[model samples]
Target: MKTTTTMLGLLLGLSAPALAQGLETYAEFPKDTPPGNIAIAPDGRMFMSVHEFYGHALRIVEVKPDGSTTPYPTDAWAHAPQEDGDGLNGVLGLQVDREGILWMLDGQGENQTGRIVGWDTNTETLHAIHYIGQPAARPTSFLNDLAVDREHGAIYISDTGDGANSAIIVVDLDTGRARRVLEGSQFTVPEDTPMIIDGREVKLGGNPAKIGINPITVDPTNTWVYFAPMTANSMYRVRTTDLLDTDLSDADLANRVERYGDKVTSDGSTVDTAGNVYITAMTDNAIGVTKADGTYEVLYQSDEDLPWPDGFAMGVDGFVYATINELHRSPVLNGGEDASLGTYRIVRFPALSATVSGR
Candidate 1:
């Protein structure tokens, strides 16, 4: 299989090497449809967010073990209007909790306010829904990723603020109240650092997109929330307690932020039961894992074959699954021409040596 990928790359003029030993292609999307985000349910089932970014209709569907997909919840949730209770504008970051619940953050492509929807995967029933509109978000905000604290009954979201301001929005699950916090911290701002792929800086129309805090995850212990900006070389974390407290002054909460460690240009991340953090090394075209002691290693790497690795989710069956598509090679970034030469793929490898749980 590795040889096949390498051969394909060569034929396309890409100098990609063979995939690392254990990496395997789990599924592939047709050339017309590109993947957006992936999440794993507690029952070992996989779900993918299908959106209009790649010319596909908006929907969230389940990817079965044998490579079949069925619309999750229902087609109604996917195509519902913006004003309806169960309407879904679009889904970006998807997460499944330990209790078999599916959570989705819908950005709706900046035309409307974003909302978060939670559903019981087992029952296929709506559990909770909250709108992050006017008071909690600005029109320029891009609610990129999220970390759910089940025990604390809260959800922490990262606002990328593509053309506006950046901040962390903390939502109280019980009351559906969300407040923006830690606005304008260096941790949430785009650094001067540039993201490179295949030894060349990734640019959109000759200029790199200034992405802010995007990837976020909660440690197994639920004590800390870890996050990083797409343009940064370092990771930052803060106590969950401080983030949940609205009484803390912005300066005081900012003081609580602690630098986790240096990291590469990363997109998505999750921690294993052993407290090891696995991140998508977007620039290196691989998965990078950091130990509890702060050591980093390239867990899996492929040449140009993998493209820009994005979302990650650890399944109950003991493998971490990731969505890989040529995001940097898309027309929006690639001088008005589609550079994503082939099919988008989802790949997974054996999970870490132990169990991983967020609760």
Candidate 2:
């Protein structure tokens, strides 16, 4: 296994070790057990979701500083329930909000309905469960990512449909009402571009598969929601006020969508306090940051164990944590059996200058 250990240089006024100048493997998962995303609370407790593709049987778990893992809230929630209207079926996107609450976005799965659950970190109890039911959620809807707009009692989610029905779902925390917007619009659907990883095309069943509207982020001011397709290079944003207004017609909402900037092939995303958006650049095996002025720069690139930096969480401790899970190397995408070696990793670097807003 190749590991690059060096203190990282400080960027954006944040100090990092030289060995870990850009990427640091903070923790490692057992071989074949890839993590989905990482969420760090205000108290520095780190939690991660297990990717269903790896068959971990657990939805989410907490990572101790010593690297031991334990299920969060309870063991039962980690092993999610299968009923349609109850419990989490799949957990992909997770965020720790300003109020010390952990928000979980459960995507559509077998016998599982799309839902968002909020857990109060202090109480260690389920605070709220908002299910996206009926016309807003279809069987094809793959709720891939989320951004919370706590002040407006709303949560924005990206429904990365099965290549044909991509859209954005906005949930009202107050009423548990979820609305699907921009369904099948050019802004939401994936382009016909092939996904490349490790200089090779990522294929499923001998055909290249593309992910649509897979990355979403809420700016620190809670004013805009930025998103993009995992297989595309363009990034776009829409005002939070516009997203929450039910009166706006689909045409009106689509018109409000603003092309923020161009990004590398990205998976998960998070916004820092200064309005800079950091994206997990999977193809480049690094993290990329987009400034408020719509300019982007490769903040950190690595060629070591960080083969694919998939998901991200801008931590309260001024470190941005990511799940270095190489999805392209999974057996399901690799003609039945994975021949890859090395452990799945969780890496972090000094990141956001402040806590993420909108719990």
| Model 2, span 106-224: residue lDDT tens | 77767667788899988888888888876998788888888877778788899998767889998888888889999888888888788787778887767787878989988878888
| Worst 10-residue lDDT window, candidate 2 | 11-20
How many backbone clashes can be found in candidate 2? Answer: 11
Candidate 1 stretches with Cα past 4 Å from truth are 1-19, 80-86, 108-111, 204-206
Worst 10 residues of 1 by lDDT: 1-10
Query: Relative to the unseen true structure, what is the C-alpha lDDT of residue 142 in candidate 1, on a scale of 0 to 100?
Result: 81
Task: Please list the C-alpha lDDT of all candidates, in the order they appear.
Answer: 0.77, 0.79
TM-score computed on alpha carbons, candidate 2: 0.89
Best candidate, lDDT:
2
